[model samples]
Target: MDIVVAITLFVLALLIGVEVIGKVPATLHTPLMSGANSIHGIVIVGVVIVAAHATSPLAWVFIFLAAVLGTMNVVGGYVVTDRMLEMFKSDKSKKGEGK
Candidate 1:
């Protein structure tokens, strides 16, 4: 498990992720984001597990940052999903509607 190999894999994953996401249609982005959020929830769990075993100050800092960022990402995803759903809802107070 060399550092160089790990970094290379990370960079490759990043590039592939960006390319895949960039090609997604705007209409499908919300659903894709919703799914990604669920995955992030799992990431949060993993962070907690890592935090439990963390010993060094640097390890704790990284774990804390991961937890915070993962939580934010999950919350933001849901907010986006909710707003997208709202777009499809009809307004009851609109003039001729629901009269």
Candidate 2:
């Protein structure tokens, strides 16, 4: 059945996700977060497709949550990446005092 396949894929993805996220080191989290956002973009697309074809109120609710979460992932990732990169930018760049 369709539900069975969906659940199976979800479980597989969840397992793979756990394994992948568990391996990354804390110091690299910021840089990896940007890449993770790109990965979440794929999840966004998958969820959109599922949402579009979704039926029933419960399914819509699930789809909505997934979409919101995915959007947050992307937006938050960009914010963090920008801030991290901002810190890397020299103060002299702003003051026009660089060598």
Candidate 3:
């Protein structure tokens, strides 16, 4: 069935993502996440396109869930990227804070 295939693919992708990310070094994580964030943006675009054609109630539900999950991914990625960039702030910026 289509649902079965979709679920299987989703599970497989999840497992693969976990496996690949788990082996990355901490220092490389920020750059990798930044790139993945870009991919998440594209996912959002694709989900939007899919949502436009979603007609049935079940179809709409799946599209809604996908859009939400994709948005979370994009937001979380940017948050991580921002925190990582903060680590490299200039000395002047650090001293300017609360002074």
- Relative to the unseen true structure, what is the C-alpha lDDT of residue 2 in candidate 2, on a scale of 0 to 100? 100
Candidate 3's displacement at residue 51, Å, is 1.3
Which residues of candidate 1, in runs, are more than 4 Å off?
1-29, 91-99
lDDT at residue 68 of model 2 (Cα atoms): 90
Give the alpha carbon lDDT tens digit for every residue of 10-60 in model 2.
999999988887676685577677766756666778888897789899999
Model 2 segments more than 4 A misplaced: 1-29, 91-99
Judge candidate 3 against the unseen true structure and give its global Cα lDDT, from 0 to 1.
0.79
Where's the lowest-lDDT run of ten residues in candidate 2? 83-92
Q: What would the C-alpha RMSD of candidate 1 be, to one decimal place?
A: 5.6
Local accuracy of candidate 1 as per-residue lDDT tens digits, 1-99: 699999999999889878877677686677777866755676788888898899999998999899888888777777877766565343334534844
Which digits, one per residue and each the tens of the lDDT, describe model 3 over residues 1-99?
999999999999999888877677686676676967756566888888988898999998988898888888888778777766676464448778854
Report lDDT per candidate.
0.77, 0.78, 0.79
Provide C-alpha RMSD values for all models, in order.
5.6, 6.0, 6.7
For candidate 2, give the lDDT of residue 74.
74
Question: Considering every candidate listed, which one attains the maximal lDDT?
Answer: 3
